[model samples]
Target: MYVAVKGGEKAISQAHKLLAKRRRGDTGLAELSVAQIREQLPLAVDRVMTEGSIHDPELAALAIKQAAGDLVEAIFLLRAYRTTLSRFYVSEAIDTGGMRVERRISATFKDLPGGQVLGSTFDYTHRLLDFRLLAEGDAETSSPTARDSEPEPEPEEEAGPMGRVLQMLEREGLLVPEQDDDQLPADITEVARSYPCDRSARLQSLVRGDEGFLLALAYSTQRGYGRNHPFAGEIRVGEVSLTLIPEELGFPVEIGTLQVTECEMINGFTRLPDGEVKFTRGYGLAFGQSERKSMAMALVDRALQADDYDEERSSPAQQEEFVLSHCDNVEASGFVSHLKLPHYVDFQSELELLRRLQSETDVAQPVEEQA
Candidate 1:
């Protein structure tokens, strides 16, 4: 058994070497740099950072290259790296209201403050495949001229504070007022797992949860399952500065800025005691310019708000445990991937049991025939 275990360890080490070699691919081709992925494929890096619950773009980019562009695997790598780091300071709450607005839009209003700055988007893009991109890739490798061929961007006008649309409704006394609690928000990473989690914990979970899973849940809500009449109150993408107060300083100090996407989905499913109907909100905040994930998170957030409003919990989205438990892709992937591990002993035992049962059945049949 000892010898067999030693051999297995050697095999695993060799397998890792093969994997590393395969990850490198054809050596003649230029090796993809972490900088290229961080700058060029930024959205992928953003997704990795967001899902991984880590905020380092360079680290995320390195993880992406190491994982061979597998974003989920990259997320796994980032999470694993996170486990090694010591928690220094929990940064002060991010102030999205003071964001350096890059993209801001509202579906409920035709026009509003900051006037729909569509900074960078694929919303108006034609779905047709552009073979030019393939040619461009080839040109980038073969020709240096192709690198700076794209036209330079124009100078932008000085922008004002991009105000929240929800504020406008709030001024009209039409929006539901939020609890003015000064309670420090709990960190999900620090806390022990509990069922039917609080708002802060739930938000943290949804923020870092699987994007595709949340998107599907959001789609289901829109398609009438746990449907809440949602209007995109606001969807904003931009950079927000982070501040942390060290124990020594006792004052807030600027740490760094992170690109974030925030979505506020207004739902009219609840009424007030004053006999005047008001719009309740579902909010989502994620790292980088992740509009879809934030929006989906908002929808799922609203659906999960069913308990607060005494709404029927008939849909999968409304069931907090069901969504929260299964949403962590890392946990889900680990369980699913464990199938690749050896189940030799279990299989052998099952095989022997099956044969013994078959033999007993054969003996019973022969005895019955003789009788």
Candidate 2:
């Protein structure tokens, strides 16, 4: 057990200095800029932004840089920074149907209205390291590949927003749709904790939850834990305009364009009171191009809705308290990281108890031998 000590202000300060030095290793090498991280490590920045519950890429990159690329630390930094900002008007629910889609695909359909758009993805690429990238990383040591070596492909035809896959099912009355209420949606960030949280609150929590945690839970559902005959309805990644209507202006105004990934899962159908069966939807949305996170979120969403569908809720994914309470990386990190702090007193107490038990055992053994 480590012994607790006091009077180390100078030592603490020196340790911080040492930490900074280590974070900036090898003085001879060029330092990385926040811009470089924001542009090059875009997926990392996107993850930070999504789980951080903040949409600013520049700030996320800055936090990543300051935290020495520790993403959980970066997420924590972003959340703390968000507390200082003033509350503005809440934007209206984004109309993703009209998204300027860059990538659109449907697993259920071989060919949809928009056609399968294979945008920038690593899905087809072999898991092999290009030595050229290893040799000339950001330095660009080699000459550029000649355009003349390969035939130029024909450009894609101009098209407006692609059609939604769910619309097809909805048209046939095969999929039940979410009822839209006129009331303002719940502000999950400001709302106080309460039992039996609304669907809005649950969704808000899930979106901000850790990607890895959600992925694991989603995988568990597929492995028969919370089995829902799930089919990926659609997955889309694109930029959408954020719009808000002010009380005074009485008209909607475009606020900002945000990159987002959305996934929809068509789960096993349930027979209603009218004796008609309709497929259920598990919706997932994430900031930036986070297809995996969105898909996982969708699966977990369906699992969590087991009660609503009159299905047994015995799975870990279906347990709202377990999933919501522990999915946050920032919270999980804080709980685990606290172990690094001085726990000498607690350990000493444990050691004392162990010693007492051992002494009692020793005394009992001697008496029993005498008997």
lDDT for each candidate structure: 0.87, 0.87
Which lDDT value does model 2 have at 110?
75
Per-residue lDDT of model 2, residues 32-61, tens digit only: 999999998899899999999999999999
Off by over 4 Å in 1: 1-6, 137-160, 273-275, 357-371
Local accuracy of candidate 1 as per-residue lDDT tens digits, 1-371: 01122357888899999998998999998889999999999899989999999999999999999998989999999999999999988888788999998888889986676667676778998988778777755533343342556833432332546778998888888888666588887688888558778888889899789999999999999999999999999999998999999999999999889899999998874676667778888998899988899999999998998887878999999999999988989989989987776677777888999999988888879877667
| Candidate 1 TM-score over all chains jointly | 0.88
The deviation in Å at residue 245 for candidate 1 is: 1.5
lDDT of 2 at 311: 83
For each candidate in turn, the TM-score is 0.88, 0.90
Clashes of each: 0, 0
**Clashing residue pairs, backbone N/CA/C < 3 A, model 2:** none
